[model samples]
Target: MAEDDRSFVDHYAVLGLPSSEEGTKISLEEIKKAYRNQSRIRHPDKRPNDPNATADFQFLTTSFEVLSNETTRSCFDAKLRTRRERVLRDSFQNAKRRKMATDLEQRERSVAVDPSQEVRRKEKMKADELKREIAEFKARRMKKAFEPLNRKDNVEGEKKDSSLDKGRMLKAIWETSAGDYSAAKLRGIFETFGIVEDVVIRTNSLKKKSSAIIVMASKGATVRAIQSMSGDTTNPLLVLPLESIAPSFSSTSSTNQNESMGPEFNNVVGAGFQNYEAFVMKKLQEAYEKNKCM
Candidate 1:
């Protein structure tokens, strides 16, 4: 291996096979199985444009090639064994030094000192306690001064945070015929607008279809997402604010949410959603009238 690649290229570790310590005896079948599993996880297409992904995938392939064939396998196994032995030897030496250093420190601390030294140590300890008390006093005063400001900000922050609470959450519905509304896909679509806190996919057994509820970080995020994702009828996907959906579907609880979300969740941005829609519609109408005059 080259100097640059040496740090990262561990063939056995990458292949998820037994190390030299485990008496490396991986079968050809095991190697092939491990490669397929790891390749799926590290494939370039799955992680597009990743700077290190291509190199890592190539390294994985190289490891498989070297370890599978008899001639290369012998050479590689010999090098791996030597590397493991060197690592184990270094570890043992490090542990021994650490134990010796700890023993010395304990011995020095346990030994009695002269009277003058003891007096100086007691005085230093007293001084440190006084300094610590003074620091604590100052901290308390600063905290008291900032209390009102923090409380006020927290009230506003809490209102928004509670909406995205695990239980009784506020979310938007995405009704799509795409048949592949994965959480990752939805996150990718909406993340550019704002933070997506969670995505919930529920099967509608009656309709034999699937829809998703997206929980955004804030009302502004929800508005931005709706504007971008559901701006026109020409778009196949129908993005509606949770407040607009029928209560049965929109206000339904997630099976995963066991924790109690307080009554404050009722205040989540329903009115804001309506206002956002009105604003978008007004803009569209204005554009339409202007084009008619033209």
Candidate 2:
């Protein structure tokens, strides 16, 4: 056998005894017993026809000689332990070298770059950023362009809020020179312009005239009612704001005064009209002319 193979040969395995990579665990007596059994089986004189019997017997005798002595056996066991540890250490070092080489190769491949692809990637990023900026600019421009329209819509919304039930309460007077007007009839007539919250009819028996205090839901409704109803001479309605009436004819006092002094209430209302008569007549005349043209 080769010298390297001879150096790796286990003496306990040669004697047919149980052994491990670390070392054997046999006493001198146990070694002698194992040696005697192996010598009987591997002896040249006992195996006359076997061609390799002499070499096998020599190997067995060498194993027996080494294991039978304490000092030699200790040296052999130490050499076996050192050889096992060396093999393990070499295997670990080889594996670590292979991993480092693989990592270096991967890093080199990762560092290798395509210049055109890099430029394209940067250009794509810039384009995306520019698109985002343009979108933001367009949004700002659109908002600025529509600002006037938005303000107009807000003004219309404010007008609607004031004209509905939420804002100021306005009052108008409805006086008829000839016909008697019921509260329900007046409410029905005035509701065409807007909401009529209330209608209070007052009759003057001596003058044969009827008038009503119309409580409108809002200023817009009151204005619209006055514009539409003021200039009809046959069924005249002196639609005026309650604030335009005399100081004595307040909202609270008007009802009481109308009930107690029926004809005198009309007189007081006429007296209050002196201040606003021209303006009211102009608007009434314009409205009448417009209606007549229609």
Candidate 3:
């Protein structure tokens, strides 16, 4: 047979002894007989005219020498086993990678088929996010509205028990639309008012809109803060005044006040409002005057 026609080279196959899995248990006598039979046909002297006769004869001789030695045959078997294992491992790995690639391509094709569904999903997500933010904003507003009533109760409780009055610690409540202000920023802002005892920020989260309560060192300092901070300036402010937190304070028309005040202050109450301190101070003055008239 032509060299190109041969599938694979094996010592047993060269000798014409079976190389298949079931024929691996051939006897030494069988191997010698097969080798002798192959050699005679492939001998160069017997086929001197053939161009590949020498090469064929040499291959037959090598097969006999390797198979006849027990050590060489054992080593060749080990090498063959290792090559088979390596081929199987490579095939498994290639198959696994091909399967993964196929799955990814299928997913891409699915997405390409219905891109509109993806867009709709993203839009719904955005809408839900907006609704959540709006709900949080409304909750904060409600808390702000009821702050005065809560403070009123605390003041009344303090009044009923004289011993509880440890020289009325003056405190002021402040709200800011910009939630980026840290405790240090709050302290810096209100430190000008008086010796600050403690600063407490209340909010659902640090990143959300928040309120701060600045406890001043003395009532005199608190009084000074009410007078100085409550005023109109080039820049408007967003803050709650001392009168709003007082026990006697009450809105003349709660519903009307909320409807009117919420809208009226909208333009000036956001993070963009400039001169925030002054604007809030002016609003507090208006609220104080309105309550006094009522």
In terms of lDDT, model 2 sits at 0.68
Query: Candidate 1: RMSD over Cα atoms?
Result: 44.4
Better of 1 and 3 by TM-score: 3
Q: Write the per-residue lDDT of candidate 1 for residues 79-193, one digit (tens) a residue.
A: 7777768778989999999999999987677654444676789999999999999999999999898776667788998899765543222344444454567789878877887
Q: How far in Å is the alpha carbon of 14 misplaced in model 3?
A: 2.8
Scored against the true structure, residue 144 in model 2 reaches a CA lDDT of 90
Q: Write the per-residue lDDT of candidate 3 for residues 14-53, one digit (tens) a residue.
A: 8877764533577778888988788778888889899999
For every candidate structure, what is the RMSD over all alpha carbons to the true structure, in angstroms? Answer: 44.4, 17.7, 21.3
If scored against the real structure, what TM-score would every candidate get? 0.34, 0.35, 0.41
Cα distance off (Å), candidate 1, residue 73 = 1.9
List clashing residue pairs in candidate 1.
none
In what order do the candidates fall by lDDT, top score first? Answer: 2, 1, 3
The segments of candidate 2 whose C-alpha lies over 4 angstroms from its true place after superposition are: 1-7, 20-25, 79-224, 230-294
lDDT of each: 0.66, 0.68, 0.63
Q: Which candidate achieves the best TM-score against the true structure?
A: 3
lDDT of 2 by residue, 131-236 (tens): 9999999999999987776778899998996665522233444334545567787789889988888777666667544556777777677666654555443335
